[model samples]
Structure formats: structure tokens, C-alpha cells
Target: MAMEEKTPVTLGHRSRTLTAEEIEKLSDDKETVSDFKQRKLEEEAKKHWDKFYMRNETRFFKDRHWTTREFEELLGQDFELPSKATGDQPTLLEVGCGVGNMIVPLIEEGSAFRFLACDFSPRAVALLKENPMFSKGSHRAFVCDMTTSQLLEEVPRESVDIVTMIFMLSAISPEKMPTVINNVFSVLRPGGMVLFRDYGLYDQAQLRFKRGHKLRENFYARQDGTRAFYFSEEVVKSLFESAGFQTKENSYVTRSTINRKEGIDVPRIFVQSKFVKPQARYLMQFADGV
Candidate 1:
């Protein structure tokens, strides 16, 4: 099997710059959530998510069947397991995999890669395991908090071929995000890739937040105690590159989500990108030959 990496094509609804009024509205909220309150929210983050899953189970989110379409890297030629000659199969690790919504679709589509998935919420993991397809598939679903846990303990270092952080990182506090990215960097095989999609700056959800919800610049605490941090392209690039990933595609994807019954049609903004872990040969080279 060839280990050649493919460049992702740029296609999607590109996000537009916010108008002056919009900017003023976002900045209008000068007050931020109190530090003591912020600490309490952070400490109880896991519990809040667990309660969320316990309450909603697998029904809250629709299965992400569109992943293959959005991320062609997961389909066609890229989906094949390495041939018997290579004596190995690729692995995909999905951090913050809630209820197997993403993995279940991939499995149903007959993807050949072995999978390792984790979410801090035990209830989410349990709900995932309850899925008959997931239970019978080539995968492992466990409880893990990426901010503090070590992926190498679950799998060998530099062994994973792909890592997907779909809408996962935004859920974390911005200050601790570097730790999570560094941890992802450690487990990926050289030249392995990360597929990411998260809320983008000035998204509807962010704009909907009133002054009291602001935790910090671009970060907010929701009424449910769950938190979200909207991203700018610069921040996403900086985070991955600082952790040794080569950015392939980093851009804002925009869309209009409509609910005619409620007379709601709002633009949704998301940051989606692909980052590759540098190959070992490149890592070993310096300005002067060794």
C-alpha cells in the first residue's frame, strides 16, 4: 500500500467578514464570567457532559453520514487497508467521540481502518458500545479526557494513521488546548493526518451569547455548564503548527441552517482543516546535514 498523502481540495461555503455593527455587538459585552464561577464550570465539565448524554442518549445528534463527502480522505482510495504485504492496518482515533455518531456511519459504509474512540463522558462511551454495529466492528471505545490523559498508554507511540477532532476542541478551555494538541501529535505516525471541524469565530451560537456568558475572548460558558471557544483561522493554524503539524487546509466553512417551523434561518460558521504530522525524515534533517 502506498503511504502517499493527498492534498485536500478547497470547497465549501467560505465565511465572510463580520460587519462593523456585528463586531460592535460582539464586543459590546464587556463583562466576563467571574473567575470563581469559571473554575467551577471547568471542574464540573465532565459531569455536565455526562449528564447531557444521560439525558439525551443517542437521539440528540443525527449520525454524521456526510463525513466521507466532506472529507474525501476518508473515502475511495484512502479507505483501503494496507495490503497483506505491508502486514499492518491503519488506525483512526476520534477524540471526543460522542455516542459513536461519526464512527457508526463509517463502519456502516465498510471502512477498513481499525478505530480507537474516546469521550470523557462514560455515559457517552456506554451509549456507543450499545450500538450493535459498533459492538461488532473493529474498534475500541473507552473513556478518556484528552486534556490530561495519555494516548500512548492505549496505543504505541507514532502508530495512529489518522486523528479526527470533529467539533471536539471547541468544547475545551482555550488555555488547556495546547496540551491536547501536543498529545495528539505524539500518537500520530509520521505523515499521518488530523481532520478537524469546529465552531468558527462569530458563529450564531457565539452571537447568541449575552454579556454574562463570556468566559474570555471568544470563549463562553453555556447555560448547561458546557463551554465553547470559537476559533479564528490564525488560532487554528498556530495551535496545530506549534505542535509540529503541517497545515494543508484551514478555512472557515459557512452555511445557513433553517427551521421553517420556528421561522429561523441562521448562518452557521465552522472552521475545518487538515494537518499532517511531518515525516520522520524531515524531522531528523536540520539546516546542516548531520
Candidate 2:
């Protein structure tokens, strides 16, 4: 059998840039320059996100309809998402599972594998729990700040088989990303995998930002207070590699969306990757003995 090292998705779409006026408006910098200097918006990241969830209330990002499609392991009979299949049955922990947008679809499909969905925002967690599909039977949703908070406190140590980080890590400050990865690493069982998806460098969203909204280089804090960071492939690869993960898949995905009424075409670029934690030395030995 061949390993699905890369996602089997088309990778090219022409890039698009927002209009100049749109850039100016987005970069207006709602905070006073003096406040921006003194308060450090990145430090108050949690507050910004909390307020973002409060304002939009689980309605901003659409449910990800592409998850199970991109990752075959999600549906393959061999992996079989969570029933009493055996120790190898895949258990999942969605790192920043906001409002269960991604997990709900899988749960609705009826899986045997257990899932733990967590978000930093209490409101996001609350909203996830509110979903009609949410139940403690196969899914467990909770509030957890992966950057500073200990994942083990809410989850068992090294128990997760798959940790999904979809469109979520970009919200963390680049400086703290290592800490977040290390934290997630601590909770993953040996040989577990982390599936990642996020904005790529020079993506349309990054190109749309103007000066005042810029936080450092590719990082930006939006007028709504929530922030985002565009990633370079090297950076993403390095971050996971530094934390003892073996890179399996690391590539960019590009898709063009057309707006017929507005007569505009938008190109979106995203990075998709998969990294695996090494199995314990003794576990390898035990398997070899068999």
C-alpha cells in the first residue's frame, strides 16, 4: 500500500489582490497609535477572539466541507473512526475546534472513533455544545487555551491519535507558535499525527492588509480585533520538525472561487501538512518481537 504523503488535491489557481480602497479601509488601525505602542495587541489575543466570537456568534466561518475528502484516513475502513475496534482505532482531538464546524459533519456521519473538540474561547465551546449533533457519546467539546493552558489537564496524556489544526494556528502569535506545537505534542500518543491547514505566505488575505493593521511582518490584527498570520512553508515545516515530528505531507493548496454577480475572481492559498510523532522505542521493540 502507498502512503498518502500528500493530499490528492489540485494545487494551482491564479492569485488575486483586493482593491486599493479595500486595503486602506482594512488597514485603518482602529486603535490609537499610542495605544498600539503601549498595549501590544498580540498580548490581548484571547480578549480579541472572545469578542470576535461574541460579535459573530458562530456564524463567521462556514463549516469545512472538505475535511474527510482530503484525508482518506477519516473514512478508510482500516482506520475506522472510533469504535471499540482496538487500541489502533483512531482517536481525534481537534485543537481549535471553533463551534464544531468541522467535527459536526464527521459526528453526524456516525463514527466509532471518539473525538475531543476544544477551543480557547468559552463562547466557541458553548456554541459547539449547542449544536444539535453534539453529544457526549462520541464527541467531547470543551474550552482550552492551547498556548498557555495545559491540554493534559482536560485530556489524558499522550492519548490523542490525531490532532487536527485546521485554520487555527495562524491565530497564534508567531513567537508563541512553538509553545503551542509543543503543548499539542505533549498530548499526542506515540505515532499520532497532526493535520494542519492555514493561510500561506502572500495569500490574498495577507496581500489585502495595509500598514496600520500589520502586526510584525505577515501577521495582522483585524479591525474586529481578531488576528491572523500568514505562513511560509519553511516556517511551518521547521515548527513541527523542531518539536520532534516527522513531516509526511507539506504543500500548498490553491483554489479559485468565482463571484458571478460581482464579476470578481478570488484565489485562496492554504498550506496543508501532516506530521507524525515517533513511537516509543520500547513499543517498536515490542512490535518487532511479534
**Model 1 residue 103 lDDT?**
92
Clashes of each: 0, 5
Measured with C-alpha atoms, the lDDT of residue 43 in candidate 2 is 67
Top candidate (TM-score): 1
Q: What is candidate 1's TM-score against the reference?
A: 0.88
**Considering only N, C-alpha and C atoms within 3 Å, which residue pairs clash in candidate 2?**
81-113, 82-112, 82-113, 83-112, 83-113
lDDT of 2: 0.77
The TM-score that candidate 2 achieves is 0.80
CA-lDDT, candidates in order: 0.86, 0.77
Candidate 1 clashing pairs?
none
lDDT per residue for candidate 2 within 203-273, as digits (tens), equals 77776666577667667778776778888778899999998898989988888778899998877788889
> What are the root-mean-square deviations of the candidates from the true structure over C-alphas?
10.1, 10.2
lDDT of 1 by residue, 129-230 (tens): 999998997789988888885566776777788899999999999989999999999888777889999999878888888779999998998888999999
TM-score of each: 0.88, 0.80
* C-alpha lDDT of residue 227 in model 1: 91
